[model samples]
Target: MKRLILVTLTLICAAFTLHAQDTTQQIVPGRVNSASNQTRPYVIMISIDGFRYDYAEKYHAENLLRLSGAGVRALAMQPAFPSLTFPNHYSIITGLYPAHHGLVDNTFYDRKRKETYRVGDTVTVPDGSWYGGTPLWVLAEKQKMVSASYFWVGSEAAIQNIRPTYYFKYHEKTSNDQRIQQVVNWLKMPEETRPHLITFYFPEVDHAGHSFGPESEQVRAAVLQVDSAIGKMADAVSKLNLPVSFVIVSDHGMTNVDTQHTLSLPDTSIVKALKVAPGGEKVLLYGNNEEEISTAYKFLKQNENHYTAYLKQETPVRWHYGQEDIYNRIGDIILVAEPGYAFSFSKRAMHVGHHGFDNNLTDMNAIFMAWGPAFKENTRIATFENVNVYPLVARILGLDITQPIDGKLEVLESILK
Candidate 1:
């Protein structure tokens, strides 16, 4: 009797382990004989940081404008609330709100890890624990498809113990042309080893926009430079003659920020009671207890003219923020600056241009343009949010997603052929 009971327990444990492994292996991809069909569809998604929707027209980006005219274009692309770079970029890949993906802001305090994640901090940026949602690269890997990334917000991290087949460490010294050439080299690989999906990131536009105002000549020149690079890259891709598509997008837009249009907390007492996460147009404040939370909320709310304050639960429904289990990642009190204004703990000069403002503002809009075999030609459509992009990319890759995602493929289905 004792031996039978032990044997039964051992069988049950083995069965449970097998079930877990089977669940993980469920995302199998159908093998296609690469030799037979030399024209399997491929995708390249590029991100130009701070590329405002109007820049292509205002700056006369001939290359980008032409691509938009030839392919499908959107009036603009709406970024998620707080309109920062890291959050929205991750959101586009994962199809989850920043609140849901656990990248609440460019800079956030993670209570679980007892660390703060800053865009400039090398260690925090690559730590996978801070990321929640599985990025597109990981999804592609699960489906047995090869993917590569020049640079992406979460690509450096290994989410769910998986990373892209090919990705470089985040380095600022790499040139745009060099990055494009590297991707092209990947494309030149044998059909079996070639990447099915590749991502490219450019930060020059955002850098110029922040250093000089969005309307300044510096930004205009930057736009033109990136446009020329895109033109060259497009030519290179065309030479490959693969069934490829290019999806161009921006993480967010930049707006002019004046040093004079700054809001400083009037009540010093609120600071003593609250822990603040600074930077960006919006400021998030946290407290140790409910009493402190209420105190901070009341103080920020009192100055309604300068900014709008809300409890995490009361944040605007449309923003879709703070809807996840990681409530502490967002904090208790949220303060969104008024248009043309920014929030700062100290009254000082701000960068000439800034983002992270309310998503509804016209200046906070991003850009979207796509050209390829999978898209319609000479098409124009109304604006859509960045979250919807994940589903579109998944569909183009012929992958199924069962995770909780905020994106809907139907929103952008009209432009697909």
Candidate 2:
């Protein structure tokens, strides 16, 4: 049960792996539940990456449908603009959009730091300085409430000098059984060391959506496997008889791209001159020279095929990106691919399924379902933004929001019992 300890989780990072992932549970010593929080209801927030809002009904994910049916089910959960994995997960956990949270995309460039933050980079992934806003686990720990994470965007890092009381560095090799047993073990601990808030993540659905397209049989298989895991986890947790609430969500939805004719800028020289941070459906290009950016934007706009180009400030107002880029992590030039379109570099083969498009698109909507002692049973609610999840979980675990965030508690308060 010492696997209840936590090690390095990045603001964007899991699994048992081949390269020696430290499976040791890192305990943030001297931390115990504050007396006032000792009896606070527990929260298990789960993210099934790329589990679209309609996947439950479309693919008949029985466990999710039944579980959410017994509690609260939302029409949809909107991902923040860009609709990528890391930024939206961080948005859900931090209640801040990618710009405000400083994770503008799964991979983004920071002019101030003169560095690129890529989700796959092990070196920068665990560095807390790259992340902004207080994660829920950080908020809980700040108030002396023990928290744990199976895997979360920032759980590996010492955000505000705090990691969950128990955590695993990002790795996928760890089996579902191992992950489930670890959660059970944590709950069996003495009250002082037990985690009141725990975050769990699954990447299979997203991986399948990316590799085989959202409608493929492979994706259905992935969704079913994740649904089965959720069912097992819920059953095991229920036997504990604790005041536990389960909040299940996804980072974003998936869509099929025009793989046969992927989008690319006509001017290779202009693209080559800028530092590029490319997402499947969008691309951010940065350079110190204003003229070069203008040239690239103009060139792309004039030759636009299945994509649209925008100067940093000219991006859609609803996106709350560009002009709101407080960290200047956004690029000087942005190109967003149209629905059914994706960007390609050097004419490389593109994946069948893609996201990172406008978050407002119906195809980009994710799922949200909450069930537990603290929620209203059989309640059906309208669609809401992923950011609001931060406040919802905070309200459930009785953690205070230390900073102003985009999420408002009222948006999700009605779902509570």
Candidate 3:
């Protein structure tokens, strides 16, 4: 009887082992949890640098207009303060204000490294230490979802020590077609290696806006060119019958720069001791000593018509700038040029267009539109800030976002199906 009992126990253990194997085989590849009943969805986020909110409306971009009607489109996307490329792009991905992300300016001094980080500088752009907050790609990769980036401001770096499964270093000269094809190739990867999240960047629109004014014919051509690329990608996705959510956005808009209306300070003792970094409509001033600070402040105040000056402590709460000064990177004084005005230290050269103005100005607004399996059709949403984009991405992918980000998922809730 004892031998019989032993044999029975062994048979029961074998049956339990087979049941567990069956359960494991039923688990979906992309879905980490079965509770959501969601297959991992594909998300492609594209950034058109310096593309203004009104470009599609003004240029008659059929593709963009179609996307707006087919999915959800914001009237405008209010960029964070400084309204520059690097900061706003990073803000959209991280769902944090530029102040919170620690990229307060496109060009900033790193006191810790004693080096200045500037755009187009290969060494600085790829260093992960300069970036703060976890971006969407980094967050997705943490959850075991594959990710890729064609080209993004900080994608080349391993932010928070996490890099996407696939990413390419940014090269401005890469043709738009080549870039789009690469993204298509990544999406075509076998299910075992496919990227669930991807980002693509295009600087042509911004380039055209800056070189020729936003209203110029060149800008219109650039807008249409990018529209064509979008149409092609959408077609490819449809052909594959792949479930994809495509998000298109821009960093900031460009406005006409008044070549005749320039603000130049005289070479006083105040000016000599002051270090001025001018970003078209915005400027940052640092001083060598208390005397320099006093002199520069008084000079700027005496001529307040050209620009408004603010101390680091007195920066407007709405601007959302100069948070905590943990890096001591924010300058002692901040200057914002009045609309239709430009700032210069010595000689002022005329640029066709410029940004980096107050965020409240309509001219500084960017573009936002999304279409895919998860969004509502024929949805037109009111304008929202770009910071909220991060949470939307997290929600679409069914990922857990545990970080302290400022984005609110409810802001875009109406657009979700």
Candidate 4:
């Protein structure tokens, strides 16, 4: 009887070992069989702040080269305006335009709350009121698939009472290498509970680009540092033998604006004349009443050196910059600077780069690259939009988020196996 019991225990141990191995080897269903027909595979979407298309093509970075050379690259990703970080990033995750998402700008007065919402604040959490629409992470959770985020707008919000299984508090001190490691570790979790969708954000490059021009040495160095970190992440993914897809994207590109290109709205006498506050770049003229609104519009129109004025409803239909509900989000009059000219209200001398230009300008066109089993290799797709990202992400995790979305699930035909 003793011998039989020992033998039984040994057999059970063998079965358990086999089960563990099988779990580790699990891969999502779907293979890149055809260029025309491809489905979502497990996805890891990385957003490198202020990453421009030219930076990848011209800067000669190895990790970017691997992603572009091995995977599919979009020529440019045009971000939704005011071309600020929060609004565009929110659009990317929700697959909705900023007008629909309600994060219209990086900093805007929320009339309902009678307060200002800034992207840098961590106090806003798990509040569906502040974060409109369903973010990709929240959608992933409903389907019982795990998701994780290092730093992404609304990731900490705890929307719909759902949170990524693993999340870190927002921290400026977090190193790029550390953030990458966190993502890799999450991916390395046991298969049954491992995050199917992971989002990693790198902001140092963007910060450097804003402080220095996109082509400045500081920005280039930051880019290289981010590139090396990305290489480490790619290596980690490879080592794990995990079948993962990667979508590398940016919110907006950056451009140089010297004093020659500077336009001060307050100096133009627009704000004082109208008795209202001047909105920053991509000029917004805010006032309390119709009389003030009319005055702001007249002031903008009179000053031809700095801006091209438009009524909130009449701002260019093609840019999709205007929506009925978005009236409160925008200023009374919209001011778009002429090419190379940046709008500012400060009198302390103008400096640095800006991205709130028309989308046609290359400076406003961001970067996008994707790789792995779900993508078609070495092919470029021009019809891509930032809003299209969420649908592809949703399909990867098998999340049934049936909410209406602006982005369509057009198969990325370039990165297929």
Question: Model 4, which residues run further than 4 Å from truth?
Answer: 1-41, 122-127, 266-280, 324-327, 347-349, 411-417
Q: Point to the candidate with the largest TM-score.
A: 2
Give one digit per residue, the lDDT tens place, for model 3 in 24-132. 1011234332322236888999998888999999998889889867999999999998888888989999999888888887766655675666665556677898999
Ranking by lDDT: 2, 1, 3, 4
lDDT of 1 by residue, 1-417 (tens): 000001111111111111111111012233322442234578999999899989999999999989879999999999998798889999999998888888898776766665667665556667787898879988877777778887788877778877777777665655778877887898998776677889988878888887687999999999999999999899899999888899999988888866676776565776556666765477767677888788767766776766788898998888888655353688677778876777654434566688888899998899999999999999999999999999998888887786979899999988899
Q: How high a TM-score does candidate 4 get?
A: 0.83
**What is the alpha-carbon RMSD of candidate 2 to the true structure?**
5.7
lDDT winner between 1 and 4, please give it. Answer: 1
What are the candidates' C-alpha RMSDs? 11.7, 5.7, 16.5, 14.8
Give candidate 1 regions above 4 Å deviation: 1-39, 323-327, 345-348
Choose the strongest candidate by lDDT: 2
Candidate 2 lDDT tens digits, 1-417: 001111211212221122236777777678889888889999999999988889999888899999999999999999999898888889999999888999898778787787777766676678899989999999998888999999888888888778888888877778998899899888888888888999999988888887788999999999999999999999999999999889999999999988887776565777677877766688888865988888877877888888888999999898999999999999898889899998775444567888889898898999999999999999999999999999989988888788999999999999998
lDDT of 4: 0.67
lDDT, residue 3, model 2: 11
Among all windows of ten consecutive residues in candidate 4, which has the lowest summed lDDT?
Answer: 1-10
Deviation in Å, model 1, residue 374 alpha carbon: 0.8
Tens-place lDDT digits, model 4, residues 1-417: 000001111111111111111112122232112221122246888998888877876677788888767778878887876666777889999988877778765555555575555443434333556777889877876655667777677776667766677765555555666667777777665565567778888877777776677879988898888898888888888787777888899988888776555666545443554422233456555556777678767766876675688877887776676644453665567778765677555554454666667767778788888888777777777735788878876765556767987787764422344
- The whole-model lDDT of each prediction reads 0.78, 0.84, 0.76, 0.67
Better of 1 and 3 by TM-score: 1
- Better structure of 2 and 3 per lDDT: 2
